[model samples]
Target chain A: MPNQEKIRVNQLTKVFLKHKERVMALEDINLSIKDGEFICILGPSGCGKTTLLRILAGLEKSSSGEHQINNSGTDRPLQSMVFQEQGVIPWMTVEENVSLGLRMRHAPKKLINERTKTYLRKVGLTPYAKLYPKELSGGMKQRVSIARAFANDPEILLMDEPFAALDEQNKFILQEELLSIWEETKKTVIFITHSIDEAILLSDRIFLMSSQPGTIKEEVKIDLPRPRQMTQVRSDPNTAEIFLKIWKHLQTEVQESRTKNER
Target chain B: MEELKKAVEVEKEDLRRRQRSKKFKQILTISSPLFMLVIWEFLSQTAIIDPRFFPPPTTILQTLFSMSASGELFEHVRISLIRILFGFLLGVIPAITLGLIMGMYSSVRHFFSPLIMALMPIPTLAMLPIILIIFGIGEFSKMVTIAASVFFPVVINTVAGVMNIDKVYSDVAKNYGANPKDFFMKIALPGAMPVMMEGIQMGQAIALLTIVAAEMIGANSGIGYVIWMNYKAFLIAEMFVGLILISFFGYLFSLLLRGLQSKLIPWK
Candidate 1:
């Protein structure tokens, strides 16, 4: 049986009014996410993945559609987003950034401190809690962003390629860290990214999108067991098979984008 | 282990170099004023410049000490400070309040922008005659002149600062369900602070600049009054004393404001 529905997006359409010309960013986009499901939206650049995520997070209004994140009858906000670059407010210290959402909700002082400390430790940023974002390197800053998103304790996390700016080594480390955190918390996530390996590694289901007037092309389920590690992925035949299936679908879309650019 | 020791030696040398440069800068800062004073004294005493007109640094110091002892300098400084303090408050508080309103609402900005533009370019001193005629060459006109001088820059800078804040901050706050009060107190205020602080500092500077001109026009007592009255009487030494006092206080105001910035926004 399917898990409880955590998020539902129906007939979501977005159009950009570019100098009196309407550009279709997303057309009849529809998605359903289950409770605690780790879903990745994998697509090429300019494929409206970010727009989809923004709409889901309520950052932007859909031109036409119904998008709902089930609130679980809580008084708190239902979702939080981790943006790709420098989402941590530069003016706030690491601890303040992590404690922000809780503070805004007026969560008790004790709970705020406890949750902030817990996530800071999880992301290995406890020592740097007193430092500002300017003092942090890019990798460390992204870790703070992750810590902050998790610390908010939202019903769903919307991450828009949060680690896309990091180096390869940092990416692997953060991906591993994020997966471990997800395994522990089981928070439903809608992650947007262009990296195929990242989608395969972290996500339970990958929704692939085609470019230039973007729409979901296919949904590829990884069917991987929980508590998976990044190290043993190369030996898993399932990883290769899923990668190939998604690549086969994506290859043509990428080629089409390139040819259009050339023309 | 040998390589580690070599690294430690290199670090020690770097520290020593830094210390040497820091000491040199400190000496230069301390000696610069003294060097100028000494040059002025030599020029005056050796007849390179007429002592009657230029006066030696020593005579200026003597005149300042006597004036200070007789309570003349203190009275003037007190009167000047009171005028400036009141004038600064009159100008700054209203400017910030209106500027914030204008920045938050486009309609308010549209209404005020043209008026502010028209008045801002007209120099504060140029309005002195009209103001004196209206307010009768009393302390009121002087205060009004200083207030007008301070008002424009603060409003302009404050509006710019508020409008210039990145939309991302509001987006993040909105995503977290921040109410308007929390949004303003936590995000908008702090985000706009660096620029607002710049505006305040500029306001303080303009207050200082306009106070002197206002006092020079018609004032019974002030540092500016001392300078003006002494120049008229050809008490060159006392005029130099007044000029020095003005410089010292101007420098102090800036230093105090800078310290306030660091205290208020230590994140930077």
Candidate 2:
């Protein structure tokens, strides 16, 4: 049997109007993601990748076209988003933040605790469960946000550059943690990022976007095998080749956007 | 066991050092007011300044002690406190309710914003004559004036607090399938708490500022009444006593509110 279609975006477009000027942010975007497939929308700044993700998450409305998220049975929520900014509720303790989605769903207290503990442990944040977000580091705050996203156990995870703000060391650690969690759950993820290496490392398919009326330029499939190690993947010759391809497309867009700004 | 015992000893020493520093800071704070009192007393005793107009701290204390001993000061304090308490509650409950509502609904905000803006700039004391005319110089007029003073700051700040919450919080709430009730209770209220507490603090301050004016305008009893009566009679020492009482009340309320703020928003 064919793989189940998890999400479908058809002719998706967005136009932002400032005064009388009509600026097309995204144009004629089309995508089909399979169940449990990790997809990344990779682009330079002003490429409208975040806008596409926002539309997918129902946080924004597309000026034209439509998209659908397939129900992954009755037990799970449709989607949960891990924002680019620190998404953890500052007012809540780490444990409370982790369990917030479950609480919203009116899940039993026992299940909430269990899921919250599991995700907190997965993110290496069990000891800091009682601490508020203000007490945490930038990296630690992102870990809580990651734990909160996973603890909810949504059918699909929509992450918009969740690790984009972290330092190099912190980024690698979280990427590893995220992979471990995704390995266990295998939930469909639509992650948006500007980094080619990050996209290649985490995604099954990287959708490269072009700027100045942004749209998908190419879809590069990362055919690396399961249980991938970051260090091992870095050493693989195939990884460099894929990186060069994505980078070639991305560099042009970045240059184009820069020169356009100089005007 | 030996290591554990050594650690306990070290911890105790650290705690003792902290306590000593804290006590030193407290003494430093107290000395400021004490120095002010000493200077005033010196000036008055030497007749460098007119004691008739600016009585020394000692004279004010003496008058205060005598008035309290006769039960008159306590009666005025009791009545003044009661009026403030009632007026504060009257302004607070409705302001909070309406603020939350306005924060959630743009239409409601649009309707109320203009009216609130127009009324907010006019000082609560400026309305004293109209209030006195309407309520006829009774306790009601004084309380209403206090309530009016508090209402604007509390409402404006509460509205701001609610609106100022980051959009990501609400988006997260919605993505997680939060219903309207959950959105308000779990998200909006707690998110807005820091600023709401700030608003309440400001409201209490304005209420205190208005209360003296309200009482001075029309009332037979209360600290304001005492100050007005003393000023009219040229009893400068008694007026200073009233000033000290009002200051004490303001300081006590601020301390109480500060304690509450810390307890509620430990995250901040």
Candidate 3:
């Protein structure tokens, strides 16, 4: 059998009309993902990284070109999104928020309950399941968000800067938690981030994007071993070389965007 | 260990002081109205202010008691409350549903925005004449006028509430496999609740105001009508009794609203 892709985007472009001004958010963005492959799209702020993810998530439409996801698993949800802010939904209790995706899809009572309980425990939010998002701290809220996404059992998980707002300790803890969860299910994950280290730590491959009319500039494969730790990235001689390469590519793009903005 | 104990003692002392201060504030709040009533009583007894207009608190209390005994106060309050209940529900239910729909769909908003904007500025009392002309001096007119008054504040506030909900929430709903019904129920309704509560409270306040004005102008059997009749007859104490009853009910309803708000939007 031919190696058919799980998700394929062909010349996908998005133009946002703001204040009657044409703003090209993404220009000819094309990418493909295999099933269960963790991919990260790295870019600076306002680089349409979020726009690209939104299109893939079906929350926004591309202006030109087609984006398609071939879901062989008919019952599983096509995609589930983890947003950077208020993702767990403040109005819902942790358990309710965690079960949102499943509930939305009309999943049965027993499966919803079992999955919610399991995921909440996996995210260390079992004690907080009955609490509202407002009552929980930032880290705990994100844990609920993460748990909700995983519990849905979607074919693909699209996370947009899920840890960008957290403090270092919370970010690292959640990142480790995310890795643990992802390792088990290994659902195709597309994570968008500005942090180079986050991309290196989480993704099997990094798609480096440039700012002006956001497009993929480079794709660097990360052959880092599974069961990875943050400390391991520091010691691995290969990681430094990869980090420098990504940094150089991103640094130049950022500088170029800054210069254009000044003009 | 000694330092830790000292720290604990300090914290306890601080908490006690805070509790004491909070108690003092509550006492002050309760006593301020009574203090004013006492002063008013003293002044009225001395005939400092005309007893004809500013009757003594004791006389007003007697008026209240006599009205209660005669069952006139109960009849008036009951009729007015019935009007308010009907009018409030008539305005609020549709207003909220349409407001949420408007918030979700801009085309619906566009169609209604001009109509609401044009209608909102005209006072409910101003429409009373037209309402009277159409429905005549009946229960329907008073209720309709009150409903008009109750409608705008709730609809506008609810729309604002729904519109101001974080965009990310709806996006999250769409990204997941949430159907349209799920979006409406799970996302929009609960998300708009805190602001919608504001609209409902304002609706209640206006409903009270409109019902009073409406009863005084058009109806024959309500608290407002009784107050107006007492004014015509120069029964100053009875009018004061009516005013005091309105104040009491207003305070009670506000407390009820606070309880509902806390129950529904505990996260807020």
Candidate 4:
């Protein structure tokens, strides 16, 4: 059941009209994701990692090819996305923002209340639940986003650099919080990040992508033990090895991209 | 422990500074206008200025007090208030509805944007002649003109408010599988509300200003009528009473609106 195929992408392509010129953002992205697998799409800037995630979230249509998220549960949503910024609605209170996904789906009151309570507590936001998102710190707002994503109970959670804006301390804490929740819920999550260490810490597999015609360059399976803590992951010998691998791959691509732009 | 004590002392000093500043501000706020009123009373009592045109503060206050006691001011204020309230509701309801729709749909925006652009420039008072021709110089004409004034500001702000909602919110809502109804009510209305409230406030001010002109030009029963009648009869003090009353109500209504705005969207 753990290895059951939850997502499949076959030769998926995305082309964008930037200033009226057709630029290929993602070309023939193909991947098979197992149920409950944690995926990190690692890449340099403009590597089409976010575009792929947005496509999966159904926010944008793929130009060609196809992808599918198998929703086995009758009523559960297929997916929910945590945006990199402005994820929490400013006008809504923390409780309201967290309950947005469930309430939008018109879930029963008891279920909404129960899940909202559970997630709020899990994210350590029980005390701030009644406050508006505007009153919260940047770290706290991201907590609301994470809680809302988990509380939705979607088959898949798509996070596009959810902790990228956080400082080291807050990011480390939220990353741990996310990992613990993922371990308990066993939900499929595809997190996009540029930080090699972060990808190593959270991912079951890292999909390295190349720039320009963004395509999947390599897939690295992480054999790190479950329940990862930041300190232990940083100290792990294997982590350093994998970091070097991703860094080496990313270096050439990023350099080529910067040089090409310089021309 | 030394650092903690230093921090607490710093905090106490900051609080004291803030308290002193707030007290100074309070005193200045109450005294600034009172100071002006006393100077005006002094100048007018000594006949430094002609009392016929520029009446003393006491004379205006006496006129206001006399009119209120005789129930004449009450009648004029009541009629004017009713006209403004009706006109505001008539303008706000339609403008808000159209604005929300126009904001969400580009086709609607495209169609109406030009029309609004062309029409918004024409002064609401300038339309009074046409309004009088159409509605025939009664309470209806005054209401229609006031409504016209109220419409533009509310609609423009409402549209801008809705259109300015962050794109990320729409993406998040779509990902969550929100239906159209939920999108409009939860996202569109509330997202646009803070800006929309600004429009509503502006609309209230324009409505008050327009209602006076409207009553002076057409209706015979409002505060504007009293002002015009007093001016014609050379009752300058009575005219000052009407002007003062309008200003007082404008201040009162804006305060009420500010309270409503805070209650409605405290998050903003």
Choose the strongest candidate by DockQ: 4
| Clash number for each model | 0, 0, 0, 0
lDDT of 3 at B24: 99
**Candidate 1's iRMSD:** 1.1
Candidate 3's C-alpha runs over 4 A off are A1-4, A18-21
lDDT agreement of model 1 with the native: 0.88
Ranking by TM-score: 4, 3, 1, 2
Q: Model-by-model lDDT, in order?
A: 0.88, 0.89, 0.90, 0.92
**lDDT by residue for model 4 over A1-263, one digit each (tens)?**
68899999999999999899989999999999999999999999999999999999998999999999998767889999898967899988899989999999999999999999999999999999889988898899999999999999999999999999999999999999999999999999999999998999999999999998899999999998988899999899988999999999999999988998899
Model 3 iRMSD vs. native: 1.0
Q: Let me know the TM-score candidate 1 reaches against the reference structure.
A: 0.93
> Model 3, chain B: what is the TM-score?
0.97
Tens digits of per-residue lDDT for model 2 on A162-257?
Answer: 989999999988888889899888889999998888888899999999996899999999999877778978999999999998888888888988
What residue pairs are clashing in model 4?
none
Clashing pairs in 2: none
Order of models, best lDDT first: 4, 3, 2, 1
User: How many residue-pair clashes does candidate 1 contain?
Assistant: 0
lDDT of 4 by residue, B1-268 (tens): 9999999999999999999999999999999999998998888888898877888999899888888998978999999998998989889999999999999999999999999999999999999889888988777778788888999999999999999999999888898888988998999999999999999999999999988887777667899999999999999999999998899999999999999999989888
Alpha-carbon TM-score of each model against the true structure: 0.93, 0.92, 0.96, 0.96
Listing every candidate in turn, what is its Cα RMSD in Å to the true structure after a full C-alpha superposition?
2.3, 4.0, 1.8, 1.8
TM-score of chain B of each: 0.93, 0.88, 0.97, 0.94
Model 2 spans with C-alpha error above 4 angstroms: A258-263, B1-28, B132-138
With candidate 4 superimposed using the best TM-score fit, by how many Å does residue B204's alpha carbon deviate from the native? 1.2
Q: Model 2 over residues B1-268: C-alpha lDDT tens digits?
A: 9999999999999999999999999999999999998999999999999999988888888888888899988999999999999989889888887888788789999999999999989988888889888877777777888888899888888888889999889888888889988887778778888888899999998888788877887788898999999999999999989899999999999999999989988888
